[model samples]
Target: MSLHSMGLELVETVIYLTNTLICVILAVLVTDAWFRGDHKGSLLYWMIAAWVMFAADVLFASRPLLSPVVARILPTLLVTVGQAILLIGARVNSGQTKVTLVEPIGAVVLHAVLLTVFHFLAPESPLRRVSNGLIWATLAYLSYRGLRQSPPVFWRSYTAPAKAFMAHAIFHLVRTVLVLLPLSSTSEALNTFVAILGDLEVSFFMVALFVGLLLAHLKQRNEQLSSALAEVKTLSGLLPICAWCKKVRDDDGYWQQVDHYFRNHSKIRFSHGMCTDCADDFRKEAEKLQPSDL
Candidate 1:
C-alpha cells in the first residue's frame, strides 16, 4: 500500500482497537450489574450483544490477516447479528415477552444481501462503503418502534435509547445517500470528514446505549424495591412470637417485643390499656387487698 493508504489503515485500526477495548470494559460492567441485580431478560441479552459487538470490531480490524471473503462476510454478519440481538432485548425491555424475531432476522438477511450485491456489482464504489448503513438503520428503526411503545418509566428518561439509536441510523443513512451525489463522491475532504464523524458518532452511540441500558435496569430495580417496601408497610399475617415473652421474631430472626415490633413495622401505636378480663382481675385483687391490711 502507498504511504497515505498505510497511514489511513493505521488510523482506522487504532480507532477500532480503542473501540474494542471500550466494548470489553462496558461488557464486563454490564455483566457485573446483571449478577449484582439478579437481572435477566433484556439485561442478559444486552450483555451478550456487547461481547458480540467487540468481537465484530476485532474481526473488522483483523481484516489484513483474514481471507478476503471471510473478512468481508464475517464482520458484517456479526454486526447484523449483534444489532438484531440488541433489538430483541429492547423489545423485552418494552414488556414484549413474545417479541418476534422476524424483523431482526429480516434485517440480517437484508444486510447480507446488500453487502453481497455491492461487493460483486461495485466493489470500489463509495456508496457501497456505507451501504451497510441501510441494514443498521432498519434495525434502529425497529428498536425505536419497540422502545417508544414501552410504558413510561416514572424516573427514567423517555425514549432516550430509542432516540440515540435512531440518530446513528439517520446519520449513516444520510451519509450513504450523500455519497451517491456527484459532489459528495468527488470531494475527498468531505469523505474524510464523514469518516471521522462516523467514528465519533459510533462511539457516542455505544456509550449512550450502555448508559440507557444501565438506567433502564436500575429504574426497574428501584420500582421493585419500592413495591417491596410498600408491601412491608402493610403488615401481613403470621408473625412468629414467643407466647410467654410476647416477642415477635422478624424475618431476620431478631426478636422484638410486641409494642416495639408494631411501632417499627406498622402504623399501629401503643396505648397503656388493659383488656376487660385483665381489668376485672385487677379490680378483684385490689378489692381483696385492703389499705388497712398494708
Candidate 2:
C-alpha cells in the first residue's frame, strides 16, 4: 500500500480506538451510578447501552477476525439496539407511559433482518446506505423524544442528551441526502469522503454520549442533593413550640401539630402509636377508671 493510504488507515484506527475508550469509560461511569441506584434502575440500561456500543467498536475493529457477514452486520446491529436501549432507559427513568418494549425491539430486529437481506443482495447499493442512515436518524429522534418528554424531575428541556440526539439526527439526514444525490462523477470521492466522515462521526458520537449522559447523571444527583438540603433547611432552626399544647410554630408563625409540622417541612408522616411507657400508663388509667369516667 502507498504511504498515504497507510497514514489514512493509521488515522482511522486511532479514531476507532478513541471511540472505544470513550465507550468503555462511559460504561464504567454509568455502572457505578447503576449500582448506587436511580429511580427504576434506569442507569442500568444506560450502562448496558454503553457497554453494547463498546462491544460494537470492538467488533468493528476485529473485523478481520470475524466472518465477513458477521463483521458487516453485527456492529450496525449493536448500534441500533444500543440506541433503542437508551430510549428505554429514558422512558423508565421518566416513569412515563411505556411504548410496549416489543415495538422498539421489533423495529430493530426487523431492520437488522432487512439489512442482512440487502447485504446478501446488493450490499454496495446507495439504497442500503439511505435506509441505514434514515433508521439511525429515526432512532436518534426517538431518543431525543424520550428525553424531552421525560418527567420534569428526570430531565430538563435544554440538556446535553437533547443536543446529542439532534446532532446525530441531523448528521445522518445530511449524510443520507448526500448519498442519495446522483453525483456519478464524484462517486469514488464521495465514497472516500463518506468513509472519513463516518469515522469522525463515530468519535463524535462516543464523546457526545459520554458527556451528555454524564451531565445528565450529575444533574439528577444535584437535584437530589438540593432536595435533601431544602428539607434540612426547613427543619434546621430552633422552633417556637407550645410546651402545654405541644404544637410547633411554623414559618408563618402559626402553631401547628407536630405531625403537621414535620409533614410540611419534610417527607415525614405520622402513624399514631403509643410507646411502652404510654401504653402502660394507659392500661393503668383504664384499670383505675370507673364506668362513668369511661
> Across residues 1-294, which tens digit of lDDT does each residue of candidate 1 receive?
888678777887888888788888888988898888666777888899988988988997899999877887878789889899989988987887588999899888877887787777877678556667777887877887777777554123644677777776788788777667688768877777777666666667788887777876677678878877886865777889897988889888999988988887766799988999999999999899979986
Candidate No. with top TM-score: 2
Q: Whole-model lDDT, candidate 1? A: 0.79
Pull out the clashing pairs in model 1: none
| Each prediction's TM-score versus the true structure | 0.74, 0.84
Stretches off by above 4 angstroms in model 1 are: 154-159, 236-294
Q: Which ten residues in a row have the lowest lDDT in candidate 2?
A: 150-159
User: Tens-digit lDDT track for model 2 on 1-294?
Assistant: 988668766776777777888788878887877777643457778888889899988887777678989987888888888888877876776567655577468759877987898889988778877877888888778777777765453345444776777788899999988887879236766866876897789778767765677677777788889999999888888999998999988888899999998988899989998899999999998999999996
